[model samples]
Target: MSKVRIYTLAKELNLENARMLEILDGLGVSYKSVSSTIEEDTVELIKQIVAEEGTGSADGEAQAAAPAESQATQSQATQSQDAPEQQETPQAAQASATAVQTRDDVAPASKAEIPHRAPVVTIMGHVDHGKTSLLDYIRKTKVAAKEAGGITQHVGAFEAQTSKGKIVFIDTPGHEAFTTIRARGANVADIAIIVIAADDSLMPQTREAIAHAQAAKVPMIIAINKMDLPQANADKVKTDLTQLNLVPEEYGGDLIVVPVSARTGEGVEDLLEYISLNAELEDLRADPNGQFSGVVIEGKVDKQSGVLATVMVQEGTLHVGDFLVVGENYGKIKAMMDSAGGRIKEAGPSTPVQILGFSEVPTSGEKVSSAKNEHAARDLIASRASDRRDAEGAQVLRKLTLEDMMGPLTTVRTVNLILRADTQGSVEAIQGILARKESEDVKINVMLSGIGAPTEGDVLLASTAEATILCFSVTAPGSVTKIADNKGVDIKSFRIIYELIDEVDRLMKGNVEPVFEEKYLGRAEVRMVIKHPRFGNIAGSYVTDGSLKRNAKAKVTRGKETVYEGTLVGLKRLKDDVREVQTGYECGINLDWDGAEIGDIIEASEMVEVEVA
Candidate 1:
C-alpha cells in the first residue's frame, strides 16, 4: 500500500515534526524517527482526529479547512485565519468553507494563491565590494570548516544556516546580471542586499542596483563591506544611500544598515540577525501539501548528468519520483541534490536543488511545476511552446535594409532618421538632400545630425521617434550594435556618397533592396606603427591575404576588437604612391585616423550592386 513519512505528513499539516508525533501517539501509529512511514488509512484517520481537536478553536477550524478540496473550502478561510480581529463562533467552520464563494457573490472576484516560503534574497551592488566575500563567509560556515580565499565563483544559489534562521542567497555577478534576470520577468527576490564598498561609497553600478531593487518593489538592506580597510567609510556609504532615498534605520529611516568586514568576519553576524528579524515581519510561509510549482534559476547540459536544472521551489514539496515540466521540457525527477551537491530525496519551498532527468535544457528563469503524470507534463509543455512561438513571431523584425523601399507610408508614418557621417560637410549635404525629399505622401526628416558614428543616444532617439539611423563612412561602436539589436532600431552604414542618396530614393519609392550592394575586397596587417610629426600615424603594412586598395573603405582592428573605421587615405609600395598592393607585398599606408597601434589589421571592401530585373 502507498504510504508517506511522518515528517511529510507534518509538513502537509503545517505542524512541527514533534507536534505531529505527539498527535499520532496510538497503537496503529507506531513510528521512531519523523521519516518512519504510516499507512494511507492511518493518514486519513489522523486528519480526522486533527479536525475534531481543531474544531474547538475558530482559527484552528479555518486552518484545518485548507486540507479540504471542494467549492466550499475555496473561500475566505485565508482571511479568517490571517485576520487576528476575527472572532470565533460555532459557524466558523461553515463560514470558512464558503468564504471564497461569498466574495464571488458580492464583489468581483480575483484569485491569488500566496503561500509562505523562505525569504528569497538576492545579493547586489558594485563589483569588488566584497559581495562575493560576504556570501563566501556565510556559505563556508554551513558548508565547510576552514575558509580558503576565492572559493566563491558564481554558484547560482546556496542555503546558509545562521544562528537566527536559514536564508537562500542568490548571488549575482553584478547589477547588470541582476537586471538581465529581471528583464526575463523573474521577480523571485524578496529582499535585495546592496553591498557597497565602504571606502568607495556608491558607484554608478551601485546606484543602478538600488534603482532596480526599488523598481522591483523588494525591500533593500545596506551592507557596508570592507570595514577592515583603513580608509573605509561607513558613514559616507550610508549618506550616499540616503541620497538615493534608502535611509538607514540608525539615521531615522527604516532601512537597516550593517557594517561588516567579510575578511575578518566582523559584524557579519548582525546582518544575518537582521535578515531573520525582517523575515519574521515579512511572514514568509508556504503550503507544503499544495501543488508543486517554482521558478527555474538556470538550466544547462551536464556531461555527467545529462540536463541539470537549478530550481527554487515556491510552494509544495518536490519529491524525487514526481514528474515535472520546465518551460517546454518535461522530465521525471530521477535525482535531486542541494546546493552543496549532497544527495537528497525531497526539496521543500525556498530550497534550491539540482534536478536531473530533463529531456532538454529549459531557458533560465523559466517557470517549473509538477504534473500529474508523463502525459500531463507533455501536454503542458506543448501548450506553452505554442504560446511562445506565436509571441516570438509577432515580435521578430523582418530585416529591413535602409535601402529597401517600403510601401507608401501611412498618414502618421514619418520616416525619421538620425544621420551621421565622417565630416560635417557630408552631414550637411545628406541632411539637405533628405530634407529636399519631403513630400505630401512621405516625410524624410533628420532628427539629429552629427559627424561621428551613430551612438547609443542616436539609437534611443531613433527608437523614440520610430526611425532608422543612416551612417556615412563611419562604424557604430560595439555597444551601439547591442543596444540597437535590443531596441529594434535599424542602423545601416555606407561609404559611397551617391549610394546613400540612391537608397533614400529607393526606400521612399517602394519595397526594394538597395541598388548597390557591398563586396569585401582585401585585408592588410599593420606590422609597425610610424607616427610622423606632420603627417598622421602611418601603418607599415603587409597584405595579409587580400589585396589592399588606396581610397577604398577600410576598418582598423586591434586583435578581435575594433579601434577605428575609415577610408585608407593613401597606400605606398616602398616610397612611391600606389593604387593597390597585392598579397605577400610589404607597403606603407596612411589611414584616415591617427590612433593606429602596432599589430592592428586593416580590411578593405568596395560597393558593387548589380541591378535586378
Candidate 2:
C-alpha cells in the first residue's frame, strides 16, 4: 500500500493530528509533512481505511488509503491492551473526543434557547407619594379613579401592553408590605421604579424603599412624579436622588430618571420605554422546568369563594388541578385567573395569577408552592404551620424583656391601637406611654405610629400586627381607612392625650372608666438663698409658667440638669410662706433639697393620680 501516512489521513479528516502522529511514531509508521489544507478529507480517508480493514469494503485505490485508519485504530487498541504502559494517554484521548462532541451539541442549543419573558416592575415609594397614580398612568388604567381618595389600598400585580412589549407592574401599598417582601430576598422585580413626588422630594418611606431596593440589589429607575404640580421641581428631586447615590442616566450614570405627572399623564410613555430598555439590557430570564415558586402579593377570604390569593410566578408553570401549599393553607387549584380576570388553565414563568381553592387565606409575602398531590400538599402545609408556630413562639420568648417579668399578670387580649401625631416627638411620647403599660399577658405593642396622616403602612401594619392603630392630631387618608376596613385592621384617631390614654387604659382594663391624673404646671430658676429648718438653706426663685403652690411636690434641676426631687416644704412671697406663687413673680421656695443653692432650677408639680393596677 502507498506509504501508510496515518498522520496525513488524521489531518485530512480534522482528527487529533498530533495524537495520530505520536501513535504513528510509536507504531513505527513512516510519513512525510506535506503542505496541504486537506485535513477534513484526510479524516474521511482514515475512516474508510478503518472500515475497509475490518470488512474489506474498499477496492484497490481506496485500500491504498485504508492502512492509516487500520493502523491508528490498531495503535489505539494496542495502547489500551498495553494497560499501564499507555493507560493515561488513551483515557485522555477518549475524554477529549467525548468533550468535543458534547460541547458541539450544547453550544448551538444554548444560544438558540435564550429566554424572553415580561419584565416584572415593582412600584415603590412613600405612601400616597403618587406610586399608584404613576402605575395607573403608565398602564392607562383607572385604579386611582376607582379608589376612595386616589390611593391604592392593596398589593396588586398587573400587566400592561405597551408599544415595546408587555410589562408587569406590582402595585403594593408603598409602605410596610413592600419592605416585608424585599426583606425576604425574593425580589419579584427586574427593575424597581421608585416613585418620588417632585414637590415632596425625599420622605421616610422613600428612603425606606431606596434601602429595600439596594438590599435586594435590584436596578432602580427614579420616577420624579407630580411634575404637573405648581410646586414640583424635578431638578431638586434629581439632586435629592443623587445624594442617595442614584445618579441619573444623563449624569453619565446608569440610573434612568424619568420626570412624569400621574395626574396629567406627562412623560409616562418615556418612563415605560426606559423600563423596557433596562429589562432588555438585563436579559431577565427564568427557567420553566424548575419547581413552582412565587411570593403571595395579596390574599383574602371571600365570603362566597372561600379563599383567594394572588401570586407572582417566578419560575416553572402552575396549572389548574395542581396542588399547592401556601403558608398555613393547602389547596387544589380550582381555577387560575390572569390579572385581567381572564380564566386560564396554566400560568408560566413571570406571570401573576389569582388562584382559588385554598382552604384558608395565605398571608401576603408568604411563598406559595406546587405540590405533587393533595396528601403531599396537606403534609407540607401542616409542617409549615407547625414550623411557623414554633418560630413565632421562639420570637415571642426572645422578646420577653425585664418589663415583662415584673409587669402585672393579666389575660392576653388583643388591643387595636391607631397612632398619629403632628410631630415625631409627640408621636414618640404617646407611643412610649402605651408601650410601657405594665401587663404580662396583655402586651401593649404599637401596630403603626408615625408623623402626619394615617398612612397605608399604618393600616397594613395594624392588620398584620393585630392591633388597632391610634392617631393623634392626624387625619386618616380616606383610602387608607377603606383599606383598613378591607384588611380588617381597626384604626382610631384622637386629638387629645388624656382621651387617647383613657381609651387605651379602658381597653386594657376591659372598662370605659377614665383614669384621672394631676398635671405639672411651672418650673422656677433659683436666683437667691432662703431659710429652712430641716434643710439648712432654701432658694428664692422665679415661676416660669402657671403657678408653684406652697407645700406642693417639686423637683430640683440645675443648668440643664436634675439634682434633687422632693415635696416643697415652703413657698414665700418676701417673708410669708404663701399658698401659691404664679408666673412672672419671684418667691423663696424651701425644697427638701439637701444641698440648696443659687442658680438651681426647681420644677414644682404634684402626683394627683397613679395608673390603676
**Could you tell me the C-alpha RMSD of candidate 1 in Å?**
20.6
Top-scoring candidate (TM-score): 1
TM-score of each: 0.49, 0.47
Model 1 local distance difference test score: 0.75
Per-residue lDDT for 307-333 in model 2, tens only?
A: 788999987789999988876677889
Question: What are the lDDT figures for the candidates, one per model?
Answer: 0.75, 0.71
lDDT of 2: 0.71
lDDT of 1 by residue, 514-602 (tens): 46777888888888988878668889988978788888888888878988888988988877999989999999889878888778888
Provide the clashing-pair count of each candidate structure: 12, 23
